[model samples]
Target: MGVSPQQHERESFRADLDGNVRAHALRCAPIAEALSGATRASRIYGIRRFFGYFREAAGAGWVLLGDAGHFKDPAGGRGIGDAFHQAERLADAVGDAIGSDVRLDHAVAEFGRWRYRTYAEYYGLAADLGVAGPIAGIVPRVVRGLHARGRIDGVLNLLSHRASVLDVLTPARVLGATGGHLLRAPGRRHATLGELGRLATTEIRRRNAMRKPVFQSGPAPRPVQQETPEPELSR
Candidate 1:
């Protein structure tokens, strides 16, 4: 159900969903009928952009895990895996604190640091995938080109959450792949160069934006207190 906003006009996309369902129904009649019966209760949930991090992730006796700690767009489909990873990490830290002389606060803080270090690249990748922008166009074309050249395993690994974005898309690897493509297909040299150039420019802009601090003209606002029993940890 998820799609790039840039690739689909809102109304047309919604209209096409019925046709798509019907097409699927043609292949599987029974399922189609069931789906049709369920249509009345079905409601559209529009796509949303979500990428956020808390400046701190642990406080007092509590720490956060999964979406409670960090969240990115659903487009990446990394939530479940990320949750499991975070849970395991938090459990390890808590176990260490309970079993040894280490302070719970210090152990939890270390867990938070590890979580950010491990998932920062994935977060960036998820943001890029979820946002409707030039990267949307660039990524598909790059993947297609790499697929044609039988060199798309890295990208596939990244999408499947089997590899970190940084590991898969390192500068040296990018340059090597682009250079190989240029050498192997002389006709596509210009296009390859252009795509790499655009990608580099986009990355630079993104990094610069990340480096720029948000300016607030007034006094800093107080942190909102949560009413829940468990403290809501942010990271």
Candidate 2:
């Protein structure tokens, strides 16, 4: 449902309106065919593309939930669902610590950390999906292989936020798909090799980001103070 067309920023604001829309729509064959004979209901309008970003979720006396806390590109269609998830968790965190100022501060601070940890991995994937460029990797080949084997649910689940990144696009699957592509189209061996290198580099960056996230904000978890009960007397 999302298309990351590879058009430059300057070209997006060009004077050739119809030419631009047609070229961009034609990036997907089905979309082009569907709109070929379709009539325009209104003059064309454009939306500026948004890159993903994250920020602090909560602080001392207040807490920000949902998109207020963080936001990502809309390519993954996760906005509504993630908003609901954040709202529900924020409500719970508040409910558990409402009676005490100290507890409330600690709870919301922990909530912020929890929020970051929950979406950190998926955040990179969503941003990648929204990047403006041609799909230059084994993704298409692996998708075709999954289709042939009737095992593409993992990809569907991932888009729906029900699965992890490596659930379906494992290293073994990538290797198998790359080998298959070379066997079928040996002439493009060099191109495929280059694509593989890019894929590896992208993964390395993703892992590095995971280890040291650049967008997250919050202090490390502080241990909660608890009243210790006196040791039970022998009975």
Which of the numbered candidates is closest to the native, going by highest TM-score?
A: 2
Give the alpha-carbon lDDT of every model: 0.63, 0.73
Model 2 pairs whose backbones collide: none
lDDT of 2 by residue, 1-235 (tens): 2233445644563455555556667788889888776654444544444435677777899887766667776677898898898888888888978889999999899888888877776777777777677576698788888888998887888887777778878899999999988998999999999999988898888788767666545532221223223322221
Q: How do the residues 71-110 of candidate 1 rate in per-residue lDDT, one tens digit apiece? A: 6666788889889978887887788578454588788878
lDDT comparing candidate 1 with the true structure: 0.63
Clashing pairs in model 1, backbone N/Cα/C closer than 3 A? 54-235
Clashes of each: 1, 0
Per-model RMSD to reference: 9.2, 16.2
Give the lowest summed-lDDT range of ten residues in model 2: 220-229
lDDT of 2: 0.73
lDDT leader: 2
Write down the TM-score for model 1.
0.62
Q: Estimate each model's TM-score.
A: 0.62, 0.71
